[model samples]
Target: MTSAVLHSLGAARPYAGSRPLVLERIPVPAPRAGELLVKIERASLCHSDLSVVDGSRVRPLPMALGHEASGTVAAVGPGVPDVKDGDRVVMVFVPGCGDCRACDAGRPALCHRGAAANGSGDLLHGEAVLRTVDGERINHHLGVSAFSDYAVVARESAVVVDNDVPFDIAAMFGCAALTGIGAVLNSAKVSGGESVIVFGLGAVGLMAVMGAAQVAGTTVIAIDPLPEKQALAARCGARAAGAPADAEALVAEHAGDGVDVAIEAVGSARVMESCLGLLTRGGALVSVGLPHPDQVLSVQALQFAGMGKRLLGSYMGDANPARDIPAYLQMWRDGRLPVELLHTDTRPLAEINEGLDALADGRVVRRLFTLAP
Candidate 1:
């Protein structure tokens, strides 16, 4: 089958503000041993994609621009036992090396060499899979370049799911949904009756709100500058929604002392500080946003030392895709995690620029690219 791959031309920075995504037809990839050739059904636009396109995040030029996606197994390479042709799967951001120190320690999210291996555009054998129109080499982004019609991914990176879930929503589970839900359930381990404050009410934040709501006696406080996002947060069971300016007041009104857990989904240093400030004594502050390298946090050392505050950095929400993806799907089936309401809009792959514009304008919460089946 022929495939149409989205290539990042050196022409212009697509994500700097808004620019067209360059699409080019390329040969379908052949899966190697321990690899899966997935025919992508849908790919979701992530904030990280925006950052990469706009040049805020540095990456190899002429790279494919998607990390979150869902698809069906078109073919499987040798020695792959768990997946077969026609199986539905969600691609995971981190391709864990099962024998790595982090993986051995039960922290696959922190796999040491995984990021470098995936980000360097080199395949497992130190080669590049994507090629240009002239047969020149191109780079792959985040291992699973599902922006293309098909992806050649490591077997470990594809999380097989039940055929019941819609491909569009499953695509979201690949990243935003997984990260948010995992942050609450795995990273924070939020228990019933806990009060949680989530800063930023985008797709990730909204999912955090949903995860928090699933636990009995949990109170969800959502913070967002946009009113539409706040409304969505309320729909997802936020006890109250407020802007950063009203964070302290909202905390006081909802929780007598302060929140038990505070999450920073927005990547601004200011927002992180605000989230830290909202936490009660000995409360946990989880940082989920990917701030720029130069971004620095200015915190009062005395407050952290005296109050025993804990700061935790979350990557992919501390997710172990093999375990977490199915659990989230089960939650969706049980109606505990409302995946339907999280989808704010859908567009064709060709209309990705418009969809991204809607995201930037705050017109939608989670916009998906419905690829041709």
Candidate 2:
């Protein structure tokens, strides 16, 4: 019976606004059927984690909350043939069952079983693998619980990556990179010469800028409430970056015809509505953010119909991990995606609360957490 001790930061009372995440020692169990034991190298802090922690999104309490992470396979369970020990990988929150209709149609992001498991806070088998030192059960958040030094995940949740990819950069692919570029390439299918505007200059929004840059002859504009983030957006190769009013003015300059595409990365319904106004006739608007239940996206029926505008709800950027991850990483390797532009530094895992605070306050675009080995 071999086992390892690992420390994790998780909120015992999320949304209660009490203590954030408790650093608790937990046992890393041997990988079971079709599972892998991953030694997490870098786990990035995402707004999704914040949503869960701040109670804006209801999740099982005492949950080891994290879905974005990069790690090396420490061990593989029976029936898992593709991934072996020492292989570098990125964790995907959505795992596609090959037999599912969604997977057969090449849209694994909508896999029914995977979504169910994530919603239930368990592995694919509908059980939790995490346990406290005293033997108390800990809920696995999104089948990852990557806030810990080690995590056991279903094999279907991992995408094996090249050895040369940095852990921090790979970690971003778990959500940020995939969702951002996926919105452009997959959901919007944005092509060359298409004018694009991105709202909310967070990691995902900035990545949308990078993705738009890959399209030839496309004019990319970025919008954000924060001036610092607007500047960051400019650095990411956006031709223009500023407030929502500025985006409106730019749209007006196009003769009241909006850009070819408008991407909404912020979950705010207000922001989502504002994006619709920035679209030209027949333009496509892609929303990748998770919206609050009470929040709604409303549009005037006649205006929407008259303009022939298209509204797309994109979850996880609608990217298939097996195919999209490598292609996005290739862009990262070619200096097109430019991982460094999104992540400027790393924070120790112990300082996770401060990182989350910075994120909540919009002090940082992306926070990379370096887990202790």
Clashes of each: 4, 2
The CA lDDT at 154 in model 1 is 85
lDDT of 2 by residue, 154-261 (tens): 998899999999998899998998889889989999998889999888898998898888999888989888998888887788888889878888766642577989
- Stretches off by above 4 angstroms in model 1 are 1-20, 124-126
Candidate 2 regions with alpha-carbon error over 4 angstroms: 1-18, 254-256
How high a TM-score does candidate 2 get?
Answer: 0.93
Residue-by-residue lDDT tens digits, candidate 1, 81-156: 9899999999987888787899999888777667776778755434567776578776777888877888888887
Residue pairs in candidate 2 whose N, alpha carbon or C atoms collide under 3 angstroms: 10-21, 258-280
- Best lDDT goes to which candidate? 2
Error of 1 at 238 (Å): 0.9
Specify the poorest-scoring 10-residue window by lDDT in model 2.
1-10
TM-score of 1: 0.94
Best by TM-score: 1
